[model samples]
Target: MSQSDADAIDEGVLADARAEASVAPVPKGSLWRDRNFLTMWSGQALSQFGAQITELAIPVLAVLLLDATEFEVGVLTAANVAAFLLIGLPAGAWIDRMRKRHVMIWADGVRALALATLPLLWWAGALQMWHVFAVALVMGIATVFFDVSYQSIIPSLVRPGQIAEANGKLQSTYELANIAGPGLGGWLIGVLTAPFAILATVGTYLASLVALMLTRDHEERRAPEDHAPILREIGEGLRFVFTERLLRRIVGYTATGNFFNTLATTLLPIFLLRDLGLSPASMGLIFSLGAIGGFVGAIATPHIVRRIGEARAIPISAIAMSVGAALLPVAALVPALAFPLLVAQSFTASFTVLLYNITQVTFRQRITPPRLLGRMNASVRFVVWGVMPLAALLSGALGTWFGVVPTLWIAAGGELLACLFVVLAPFWTMRELPDAHSASR
Candidate 1:
């Protein structure tokens, strides 16, 4: 149960993943040609797009239908991710004990049922702000487990060298979901109701569940063990993340980025709908421009890292986020160019985000051993994603006190300051990731 003792046990468990990888290597053909990869990709893509629907629809629902205040919108946003802060640590610990694929399947099913409540309540004329908040809370819990398991499962499916390409292909979903999901959700909210738009999301989860059910996983099911205590296991993961030289700095840097990123995400829709006088469909349209930027970014990641290196790529994106956020307030001061400025802001920020995400996620997977992936990912998510709710709450309060524009400006400053994290951290000295073989050694 002690740290050294747990590490000794973990060494043996991790060999199972590497052996599985060697026995069932990723296809020599294109990843798309790999049947299991394709099935998994389809499910992930569907589920991601479904989740994207809520990002636009639920926020719009609160603002447009409920006439929620800035603080209330923040609360709504916070409610969705609060589970990450509340249960993230334990969930990560628990998931490491199970077959990740099974966890992912169950996660999708539970999520679908939880999301169905909003529309059902609305149709009966019984929907309240609390109902929406509650559903988001439940959905968040499901997402936390799914994402933890999902990230852990990826390393087992492919050779270590292929992690970048695999992550690149997976990230393509962000672009698709961002562009299509919001655009459709906005239009659906225009033609139908926001509640009805969410119904499509439920279907996507079902589709994902089915796809995952059929896909064959390479990692052998974990054999029964004299399991370590939960707290000890959790501590080991945290230690691995924080004490590992490369991972610790990345975690710290991203934690700051997540906090600042929340400010931009929490405020942008409010700014668009309230002050700029844009409709939900129009806002979604502008948002898609960002996704287009993201699409380009995903495709460009390999080339960018090859050209400039991950160290620069990470900070470059962080600095770009700061700059992108600052421009929105400047654009708003001019009446004629606000729409175009908003589009520009979203596009630039999104593009940089993809650069950071693809590079860092690939790096994380490559550096981490297969056995510790769940706990390591959870530790990172808990530190990085855990900041979202707190940031949202602060953004909401700032908006309530000083109004949306000033609040945005304040957030912009916070984001810009966060860029200092990468400059000061140990990552700037590092260039390439270590080999996966090094992990076992």
Candidate 2:
């Protein structure tokens, strides 16, 4: 569809999120009082913490145990996120026709099962690089469905105005998981080995599954007769995201950031472990300390948004994050200061990311109609996340050809350039979001 057609559709679809503010029942008291929201929150907290384990342990497994090369490590990492590019759009359309809660449950179960195989393979002395790649691929696919469903589920559990708060609460816990999970995961790797650490992740997912099974969702499941052609539905989703000027700019900035960020991270294990000689335990500590910034950012976002306004918050945070990213290459320059520099970089970068994500995600959730929530979230993820696999592969190739340090320098420069997308836009001139009612009119 053309931009003009998308603009026309935008008008009809924008209706205070279909009069959500006017018609939806606002719950009394705090979101803390809501059982469904709590259930979802607790379940996700466990899963998030568990995920941190795999994030650290998997790469450590490949590099330390499997003796994988730079390019091979990149391929393994790429496998984990490649599914976002593969099935992201169709997953959204398929999910819209089903219960989101059920999707979450199934996705969790699938991940748990996939992760369980790694330890079993290791115990049997049959673990291979292909097995690791296959598991990563499967888990990545499941994560795509779970994440889209997860974000879409929030608006149903809370009021429109509460979305920022809901997201803030969720992000806070996720950051908390980041702080603790890596440390524990690293320790687990030290004690239990990488494959065994994955067992802990499996248990956490099972716990999450139980919680999700009990949580009530308020989704307005579409009847089979109400569904459009899958391709048409996917197009509508893509149009909805791109036709909106602000969303488009945000997508551009995020995609660019993800591309460069993944490029650097795909080779970080080689640089930190091999070049600088940091142990997995030390690496985990640095990650945990750095994540403290994210926790603070999540808590501080509402106050910052209130003071500066959400529109201005986006670009401001984007600029700040790019500044933080500059430290990545700087760490390469001073080997003695590398550990502290990396920690500082992670802290500053993570903080601003939480600031940027919470504000933008809340804006997307509030403006989008409930029916389009899943597809909208998926479409956004498709664009933003799709670059990661390519970045991983490119990082591997660049690391092989140009060396890890030089590639990191390139990654840092590219991240800084990404900020221009948001900064050059009209966000600086605006203070508040356009109300959905006002936007449609």
Candidate 3:
């Protein structure tokens, strides 16, 4: 087929897919009514909860057990994000060529096996900083594969009208896991030590593996084509995301928000523990409040999106995030307000992030070709997520020079600045879904 013919065919397929997505009536009762979606959702939820346990445990292990300095802890955090920068596009390309379900299953299995080794090494007295670093990098690589494939699979499983609802459900599950996992992890670390506490995460990944295996679905077939070089494929994905006007704006705005958020994430634990002299249990309590906020936001997002429209949702949520980000400095100044500060931060951040995610993801899914979904998702994440490590490093360096409190003020200021991106962009005026249907006509 000629290029124009191929474009026409793609447009036709998208039209049919969008119409089906827009009007497919989902049953109102049990989520399990769609057994495949439920299975996939449940598996991912379980795995996310498990991942959170380790997310807390790893830093705790580094901070409390190994006596890592602020900079070292930041490096450890950066290590976690490094794989997304390095392997993200390639992983996405590979995912586009294979069965997403199988990719998810293998990814889960890899994370489970990687996590399980931590306990083994701890028992053998062979665990070290490098060991933790290695595990973090591997786990990150596995996550890249799982995440890229998972996002691509959702559109195939649900109708278009259901995308926001499905995404809200998924976010709710993740938020619930966040609420439960860290609180539970703090208690586990208090009782069992960080290494042993991480064993729980291993079990969680195993549960996900089993659930994914039980999920029944026909494998999606790929279009026949010659494979391009990995570098060229990666470049194509990057170009598509950057060249597309909507995606470019979203990426720019999201990347701005994420950079500051990541800076805070790298600093928060150190700030709470080192400067404020808060215990792990207390820190966990405060963090759990944020999770509660996330849960509320996630559950409410679909309705909120429907009510206000996706475009308006972005700036509203962005303002909330800005307010939340600015509140971090208050927690530092008035230690008595730490809990309340955390609550505000959690609530606003969760609400804003959910709105941003639902809008951007739905738009991207609508615009990108199905065959390119994995790479496109990964490539965008590569840019958005890739900055995290650099942010961590910058935060750590700033903390080292100015102390944690000053560093946090700077980070919060940076986050507040993110609002400018949205305020200035055309996204501020976009109050509804684009004229996607017109493309078909």
Taken over the whole model, the C-alpha lDDT of each candidate is 0.75, 0.81, 0.72
- 52-160: candidate 2 lDDT, tens digit per residue: 9899998988888888888888898799989989997798678878888899999999999999999899889999999999999999999888876775676667767
lDDT per residue for candidate 1 within 1-441, as digits (tens), equals 000000111222244445555656655446766788888888888887778777788888888877889988888889888988999889866776788889989989998998898888878988888888888888898887887677667667766645545665775575567688778778888887788888877899999999999988777655557567888878878888887665666677677767766766687778888888889998888877766887677678889899877767777776776778788788779958988888888788777777776666666667777767767766776788788899889888888999888887776787778777776765566576555655323
Those runs of model 2 whose alpha carbons end farther than 4 Å from true positions after fitting are 1-43, 153-172, 213-221, 306-309, 365-371, 433-441
TM-score of 1: 0.83
Task: Write down the worst ten-residue block by lDDT for model 1.
Answer: 1-10
**Better model by lDDT: candidate 2 vs candidate 3:** 2
lDDT of 3 by residue, 1-441 (tens): 000000111222343445665677565544557788888788788887787778888888878777777787778888888887787667766776798888888999899898788788878888788888888888888987887677666666765656555665775676677688778778888888888888877988888889888887665757757567778877778887887766676677777777877777787778777777777777776667666665566579889988988877777777777767878778877888777777777666765666666565666667777666656766776777788888878877877888777777777787668777666766656667564443122
Identify the runs in model 1 with alpha carbons over 4 angstroms from their true place. 1-43, 153-170, 213-221, 244-246, 362-371, 426-441
How many residue-pair clashes does candidate 1 contain? 0
Model 2: pairs clashing at backbone N, Cα or C within 3 Å: none
Name the TM-score of candidate 3.
Answer: 0.83
Pairs with steric clashes in candidate 3: 21-160, 21-161
Q: TM-score order of candidates, best first?
A: 2, 1, 3
